[model samples]
Target: MMSKNPNLTLTGPDLAALLCSRVCHDVISPVGAINNGLELLDEGGADSDAMDLIRTSALNASVRLKFARLAFGASGSVGASIDTGEAERAAKDFAVAEKKTEVIWNGPRAIVAKNRVKLLLNLFLVAYSSIPRGGTLELTLENPEFDAKFKIVARGKLMRVPAKFVEITSGQVEEAIDAHSIQPYYTVLLAEECGMELGHSATGEEIIFTAESVSV
Candidate 1:
């Protein structure tokens, strides 16, 4: 069922809930691994190999938690500012699971807005969909203004933007699907919320999405 309070904007509590949900979802697996490893350690015949597994799982879980906080948590909580190297590290760390997509970062370290952080994560999801076989994802931030511009380029074999996804991005459609399509929807939502324009297109195995800040 849909929410009755349709006009309700996302409140601080709402955002907090969303962030908590995201954190829980991401940490579940590694937490489970750590638990299993601890159980193994408790076993009477535990060996060095078991201890190594425990250590590795704990480290992996720690990294995941730190990265998730940086990506999804509040900007101030992350740090005073995030450098390009830090951004690149965060992107690569977040993009590790899929293995098919390589995230490349460009541009100087600017204080990334919280909304942009969320948009970038969604953009990564969209890029993953474009390159089913695997490819390189390039993200560039430029022209920071009331309506700043962020460019995302996904290039690889068989990179084709789905027409329906394009329609949603262009404000021609309004329906939600899973993450595969939801990313584009949220892209449009974020643009509209920020008084920005979202442009998307595909050309010769390259799909590009750009968000331009709109003039008041």
Candidate 2:
């Protein structure tokens, strides 16, 4: 008989590349639309409403670009330390228009590992999914050395973890069921690869996921 717990494994670099690709793929269209709108603005006669739309689209594209830098690029990778302020701002920028979720950061500033950066992006995506009607998300990073933990708490009107997400995070599922499904599963896999355990808990109005280092 097969063991109940089979090994879940993935390389950090590999996952980061995949995530970067995914983010780029998703943002390219909106960015292109922004470019197209700008071109239209340059060619079209001046109209207040049309100009407003162009400005709005340009702003949206800019925000998305900044978010992509943090989520997929090296916004957090500078010198030997990651700027917590920059990372927090980048995260907040992404959710600025998202009334459902607010990102709150609480932790000391330190250089986070590349893998940690990737994990944080994935966590942000997961938290985004939990808040469909506006909510607050609190994130705390503890310990930055060999042993580290990231705690994410999402509070909102409907902050319950779906069954499929739980299964994916716990290694109970293996296939991606939908576009919004893979992040959590891959997050858990990344945690496991880094010798960490991803723990999850949910209450009536809150849901929490903690990724902590585990001794091998």
Candidate 3:
């Protein structure tokens, strides 16, 4: 769906800036915890728990940064391929660190273009939002040799598509989109930019997203 209002339509740079702000906002908490841990260590009477805090905080920051590098940053040069294994590992690590989701990659380690990888990661984020009470995020790739197809399924007790997702993807919103809803809105743009079509469905406890490549 396309927006009729020019004010609601976002430019590439404006969307990119919002995504960057979202990533930085997410990273600041863990990074701040690391800094606080360092202060605790430098002060006297630091215990083993302080060391543990520092270790955990560092790991959290690292995992989130790695995942964001692929999901939100420029993970590769233009036209370069990204390692699927690396992307899978990053997603799994992030899920484990968050402790609210379990990411399972049921696909081969075939190299995919960076844009495709970004599209996958963005879809993963969409699925991630569906499960508020922790869930399984199952990622699968089909027909990798030809027109690669990717599916992300989220299953949990309270899995549901976000209202923002419907508004942004279907271009049905009357209000301007803010930072909180920009990620899903950006996911739609990224899919279109990569010449991929995104489809959404939900059944019972599962919310699924499927993306397939097409000629630009």
Candidate 4:
């Protein structure tokens, strides 16, 4: 565990760079596998296995890239609404990446403000990462219109919650926003921007995240 920095504030470019680095970290494995598969094909081995490897790696890379886009990218126009169905699809695809996590998204297909949806997806990132050994994520929504609120229930074996997670997410620690700690801070930022407040709690086997709209 790294020591907390109370004065942590990241410049726009620095934050962008770290986020790009995180996305690269995710896609690198599958992209590297694809390259390896291609190199094997070039070495005069035209086995079905090589082709299968390439196909699978390509799909994995694609799925991860899509997830990153919605999770971190500027998804749509300013003040535009994103289809809840799209967010659900992204979450489901991301969970299936390891075949170890199951996602039960009860969020309907209502259109939501882009920032709200981004907040939801980013919360998913934080929740999913807490369960290192993989688990189940159930997303339930409330008042999906203007006063949108949601809860994420994460369950798994041996769940790990850093004491600093809540601190960072609530903007308590401002001095440390590295690759490892950026997502939670980012989630907090989004919530604040969207007039929402976040809460988190954990037990031995379950972690719950709740975000509710508040008067700003």
**lDDT minimum window of 10 residues, candidate 2:** 1-10
- The predicted structure with the larger TM-score, 2 or 3, is 3
Better structure of 2 and 4 per TM-score = 4
Give the candidate order by descending TM-score.
Answer: 4, 3, 2, 1
> In model 4, what are the clashing residue pairs, if there are any?
8-174, 8-175
* Per-residue alpha-carbon lDDT of candidate 3 for residues 1-216, written as tens digits (9 for 90 to 100): 664323347887888888888888878998888788788878854768778887888888899888989987887677777888888998899888888898888878888778788888889988898898888999998865458899999999878898887776776777776778888887877777677888899999689999898864
Residue-by-residue lDDT tens digits, candidate 1, 154-177: 999977776655776544554434
* Model 4 lDDT tens row, 19-129: 888889899999999999989999978778889999888988998999888889988777888888889999899888667899998856798888888899998888888
Order of models, best lDDT first: 4, 3, 2, 1
TM-score of each model, paired residue for residue:
0.66, 0.75, 0.89, 0.89
| TM-score for predicted model 4 compared with the true structure | 0.89
Number of the top TM-score candidate: 4
Report the error of model 3 at residue 117, Å: 0.6
Report lDDT per candidate. 0.63, 0.67, 0.82, 0.82
Task: State residue 212's C-alpha deviation in candidate 3, in Å.
Answer: 2.1
Model 2 lDDT per residue over 1-216, tens place: 332224334355656666666666666766676666677677774566556656666666677777666655655435334555667777787777433467888888776666666667667767767767778889998885558888889888866676656776655765644334545656665565456777778888788978888775
**Number of the candidate with higher lDDT, 1 or 2:** 2
**Model 1 — TM-score against the truth?**
0.66
Error of 2 at 160 (Å): 2.6
Candidate 2 at residue 83, lDDT? 54
